[model samples]
Target chain A: MSAADAIAVAGVTKVFGSGNGQVAAVDDITVSIRKNEFFTLLGPSGCGKTTLLRLIAGFEFPTSGAIWLDGADVSDTPPFRRPINTVFQNYALFPHMTVEENIGFGLKMLNRPKAEIAERVAAMLKLVRMEALAGRRTNQISGGQQQRVALARALAPAPKVLLLDEPLSALDYKLRKEMQIELKRLQAETGITFIFVTHDQEEALTMSDRIAVMAAGRILQVGSPREVYDAPADRFVAGFIGESNLLPGTVERVSGGLASVTLSVGGRIEAVAPDGFSGGGPATVVLRPEHARLMPAAGAPEGAIAGTLATAVYFGTDTHYHVRLADGSDFTVREQNRPSVEARFHAGDAVAAVVEPRAARLLRERP
Target chain B: MARPFDVRRQRGFTVVAAFCFALLYLPIVVLVTYAFNAGESIANWEGVSLRWFVAAAGNAQVIDASIRSLQIATAAALIATTAATLAALATTRTAPYRGQAATFAALNLPLMVPEIVTAVALLIVFARIKMATGYTGLGYLIAAHTAFCIPFAYLPIRARLDGMDLNLERAAADLYATPVRAFRHVTLPLLWPGILAGFMLAFVISLDDVVITEFVKSGGQETLPTYMLGQLRRVITPEMNAISTAFLALSIVVVTVFFLVSRKRD
Candidate 1:
């Protein structure tokens, strides 16, 4: 591990139960989280993201492999001995304690002087904008206030790393959005390495400096938000990150760092193939909805695929057109709502979907 | 709003409730009243006086039995509550394992089985131990009472642990509290009411227990209830009534304090 690495999980595997009933909650996984970076583990429920966070928090021990924190092996270290803290999904604020007491608990456990603990708790409560509620018990506060208290309590000790497990999942949409910005601001201010776990793709994209997209006990790909969203590693990652139009095709020709694929829908399209492509092999062309443009069939570009607009969904900011091609495959193309009336397309309208070669990716088909 | 039931039906319900209360408490009221009887006979109360109460208080055997009962109850309650708390934490906090159902059943066996059977079984075990070691004292009573009260203490504690959010304990650990410290600060504080309730229940149960105390006690280690039973077998007197009234008063105070402590807070 590098000096810059805050947490390094190497070949960690956590299995629950035993014998025939044993199931691997976190399969063998390795990832190094850098210091002072907002890293996220993103996946759907049962995808082992939370389990990975728990393993790092030392609430769980791996079946095998080591967890390194700040270049020290802490695989067998108890949670209290580790220089890490967690903001639980439900906040889990101590109902019996005042917010100030909750935030100061760690410092007290560490045997800090009473004066220093009081000062630190005051600073933490101020950081989370929970100064007014500091004297109140957790149950007396609102959910959002309790969330702030949980964050304050976890961050008060200024641990080397902070782990958040879907901490915003309980909030309403508006509050979640507000806290997202607040959390990012806090991370920037604190400069503590954050390892956030969540299933929400938007949350991961909005907050993470780097993301590891996991599914079924394995990390599919580790990259920045834009990298995973634009160039996913596989069909699963492609479908998971965001909306995409995956057109099944056969590679017709490979030239100039790009591959021309003969669409199953009786058309030809070009896509940038990072890996050298072989002619006549089955491939999937990942076309993001926003990358495709809807045009009139009569004056459409020569390489554009033709289809009938099956449905038009108005989403205020953009209009999503579900188009059915000649070969029965469907693709959704999102068009921004223009001021002009002619830019809109009705259902059953003849349309051609145009995708730029550089905006599309050609990936090998997985069996 | 129109009435859903007739006034007669409502009055009939009230009458039934009053009858049940009378059946439950009238005998106790009479006993308490007779404790203050000025006369020697319990049945013939000449006037209300504190003579019997004073006599019962001054009686050396009564005082000794009461002190012995208090000692046994306190010791048993402490032992039972401690064991119950540990058992509760084990059952509720840990991941489920094989034999968990069996463990639960075993913990509750004392409550489910007839008291006479447990009393007899304990007597046999204690007798065997006495025959081997030739040691007999209030230790056997304390042991028997603790065993019987374990379920009483375990139930409330387990319920509290079950209702608790496990995440709070996890959060405490995450905040750098060792397992012991986490229990001290978070789990124990949240479970305080339940623990207090369990202790009080066990104390009351141990204090009033007759069959178990009777079977388990050595010759000179008669607890208050066992001594009262012995007196009743010989003859009924206003002194017995006075002692019973005092026991009842003590129980009521404990139960009332328990309810106050365990009442829900905002």
Candidate 2:
């Protein structure tokens, strides 16, 4: 509730049921969203991503906590009174009205002059690239057209924030990718804060300025896509945001803010702990697929461990290899499919997986 | 892949469908055609004439009764349809709550009970009121029609409300309209088709009702159906057929107009 922040949710908790049956859909979440940043809540299914969006939209109320918007406490304000709009996954266009009429409906309710409403509606249609379809009924238009109209309708009001709940989910794979870019562009042009919710990690990484990776009704970590991926706060964040090789281990020694850990698979590894830990304790090591280097031949070199290439999947731009260590644990390594590395390794080939001491992160071992 | 054109072989099924339609409509067809007969006995059909039609048109009591029925049906349809629309909106747009099922059952009770039962119940209530103050207005007929027509209006309107997209309303709210404004602008306009269809259906049903009207109506409160019943007891003439044919034409016109408007919306 200041010039910098458009919306702030403080200690918001949303519980679904009561007594013996209760679900904390959003548990004590507190976050301040900036004026015009495209913030996203990214998580898998049942992670309360959509629930948090609905809470911000005023469709659902917090069990205990306050939501402030533009310096006003709107915790108890109904959705219609709040200065926010939501674009649903299913573009819920009014079937009875043509695109022009549906878009002009809000202006009409404000008792705006008929000419003014028509002009604004026309401008909006042009903005959304749907001017040609203005006269057509909603059912007559395609899904993407309807989606554009829905965006036009929500944006026409020029609300302070636009809450999108998986608006691109209904589109096909190709359209989803296209609209992801379009949505970011639209957010940039409008300068309205967009609180987008999705279970898609790639969409979040591609579109959001900052992403909050959530799980089990709590935000496990919040940061830029690169920050969260490269330096995960916990094991869940590392596993949820992208593909990573998580190895269970215990610290053997701590020296100069770095720890040498021995894995359950009987492999010794050294990793940097930016957050210095107590010497000789339980911990886990996380290495991103891209961080591990694959070298031909058995037996580790100076800073490497021996493993066999159990499987190699050749993606278009990158080849991912599942490396099975001598002690029977398997981890994945992705190498760029460059011409130089094309014929480097194959399945069943003995290889040495190498990593820099700084590339590996010491995460808390999950019980 | 299997060919999509395999459905063409099923075209022969229309023959049986046509026979079934004929069986269903044969009696109404006979009734309608016989209304044009000029014979003294309906079975004879000696010739065709417009005399009975003219008589039906000029009958003052019949015309007044028809006007009264129209007025009551129109008023009842309006009231019932509006209440049903609000009820439908509440059921759909609001958050889930307790007591919603009990409210639903209460509103729909009249539809589930037999017409005779409702008629008797209304009669008793009206009789008690009449005995207390003798202040019976035409309001009784309006009340009865509205009660009977609510469920009819509710079902269709609720279907439309259930299928309605909340996105438009949310968009409207974000645009700065209050909740009431959103309902008026976005929700109501979208719901008009269903409301109109439901109202017209209720109007037709109310106009043709006999049992409840007979139970509650006082002297000098004859509706068209009750008047027609009285005419039947006294005489069975081509005049009745003429009246029946006119009513049938009117119903057809109403239904056709509704469908035409609804089709344009689609």
Interface RMSD of each: 1.1, 2.7
> What TM-score against the true fold does each predicted structure earn?
0.94, 0.91
TM-score of candidate 2 relative to the true fold: 0.91
lDDT of 1 by residue, A140-217 (tens): 888989889989999999999999999999999999999999999999999999999999999999999999999999
Which window of ten consecutive residues has the lowest lDDT sum in model 2 chain A?
Answer: A297-306
True contacts kept of 1: 0.87
Global CA lDDT computed for model 1: 0.90
C-alpha lDDT score of every prediction, in listed order: 0.90, 0.85
- How accurate locally is residue A118 in candidate 2, as Cα lDDT from 0 to 100? 84
Write out the backbone clash pairs for model 2.
Answer: none
lDDT of 2 by residue, B55-94 (tens): 8889999999999999999999999998888888888888
